[model samples]
Target: MTAAVAVIGTGTAAGWGRHRLGRLVAEQTPERAWFHVHPPHHDLWGAREPVVCDAQLLDCFAAGLRAELPVVVSAAPPKPDGPTQRSYAGLAALSRPSGRILVGVHPADAARVPFAAAGCGLLSRAVPGLPTGAREVHGEVAVEALPGWMVGTDASGEPVTVNLPPGATVLVCGAGAAEVVSTVAVTGRTVGSVAGADVA
Candidate 1:
């Protein structure tokens, strides 16, 4: 087994007045996989509403990822295809100073969704020895396997950096009474192995 850390994402069809942590490890939602643990560890969200993710928990997650395994794959279906015409104004433009990215990855190719609205933006720095594949969102760029070990802030995902040794089990907590448990597995083309094994 490897180590993995879950980060907060968007909300879902969850209850109102409750913050739902986006927990997905390979496009598999908590409803689908038991390993997804992006919920609260304690009664943090008990009487409160609009639960904010714990910064300390994020730190713990980042630590677990440092020495563990991290394989970034599509944990959800690629965003739906729409008009090539892109729009970026109002809060959408300001809220995301770094903009957003959408991608679809397969064993063969990964397509990158082009953000034509933002014609020019610096691409993320190179991840020296990781696998690379194109995203199928047309004019998009290749989606690099996000570093699970050492990570720098990009303002986009602004993901928490977790440092874990090989085969570490991490407990994650989120709003309400929810929790997710996840781990990372290491191997050469190890991502493929873990994904295949997971599917099985």
Candidate 2:
């Protein structure tokens, strides 16, 4: 009754696109991605807080969750509107139990919550040859290699790159990994990625 997960930021042209910050004047597309779902216990380790983000480039891509655990910074969700393009485009995590990790880019609730990460992993194949490895859903956990990367808009800011493998144990669902990935090849902004306990 007290485990958390929620990271959903669909803003900008619609809502949730890496927090879409006033682009040229703002006004992307895809209806600005909605923006919602981020509740790691009332906005990250709650205590009635707002405006979290001490900044430091968040150790450049989580830096393994702030050089090995322990972080502080909340409040960075508001795609007021711009050349917006975000509904679920990258960034969405939900791993808490004190470990605290619900990154949905912005909005809250691990991007509209739909979490389930049992164990062993590796779910990437909706087409293109197939064969990544790791399996065992419902029958009792066994998923691995939840890997895949390629965020967006670098020079303008907001870019995450991480495509690891080899004995992997990951959790990087940017844009909810395009609603369950399947082979990941997003154009921009994600609006879905639900795992009912499989997908790696």
Candidate 3:
């Protein structure tokens, strides 16, 4: 298990978003008000590994894990399909580990996954009154010292204030060829961000 988080992305318009790209493009509309969550700073001394997962696997993931660890799930928008929106509640439930945090990504995902779920504490983010369910932690605050499990995302530039350290291993999921190089440049890690299209 690598130290990583799911970082799921969804949008009404297809071209505006993708799980592979770290940027979320929302045109000038109410949807633009959605929130995005960034990855937690690397905690070298900590013993927990943050594993990224598909939103489909959230419920079953907690079965064999440490109960005391935290899970920081991203609150991105849900797919416009009815079935996709309905199934999101389970994923939202998984985000509520003992210690949790919310980073803005999408309004639909954020609405379904609130901080008041099963085992969540008071939620917080960078904006005031933005993330309705969680408490607001204004400004650029660091969560590196937190000792527990965490799952989250790097939706775009709005929430990601910290970049990954050097020598980190990343599995890129989609791209033709050039995208792989760009992800490596931004992340500064030797292991590249796997292109979404390349995943077979």
lDDT of each: 0.22, 0.25, 0.29
Maximum-lDDT candidate: 3
What's the C-alpha lDDT at position 122 in model 3? 18
What is the lDDT, from 0 to 100, of the residue 185 in candidate 3? 19
Candidate 2 per-residue C-alpha lDDT over 89-200 given as tens digits, one digit per residue, 9 for 90 to 100: 3242211111111222222322222321111011112111111121111211111122234444467675444433322233556775535443232321132333322222
Ranked candidates, highest lDDT first: 3, 2, 1
| Candidate 1 similarity to native, TM-score | 0.17
Estimate the TM-score of every prediction.
Answer: 0.17, 0.17, 0.21
Task: Give the Cα error of residue 94 in candidate 3, in Å.
Answer: 29
* Candidate 2 local lDDT, residue 156: 65
Residue 28 CA displacement from its true place in model 2, Å = 13
Better of 2 and 3 by TM-score: 3
- Residue range 108-180, candidate 1, lDDT tens digits: 2111111211122112111122112211122212222212321234568543343332222334456621211
User: Candidate 3: where are CA atoms >4 Å away?
Assistant: 1-24, 28-33, 36-44, 57-200
**Cα lDDT tens digits for candidate 3, 1-200:** 23233222223333343322223211212232232222333533333344333332233322212221123323322222344323333333333223233433334343333332222221122222223223323333333212221223356522212223312343445563344333321111223334211110
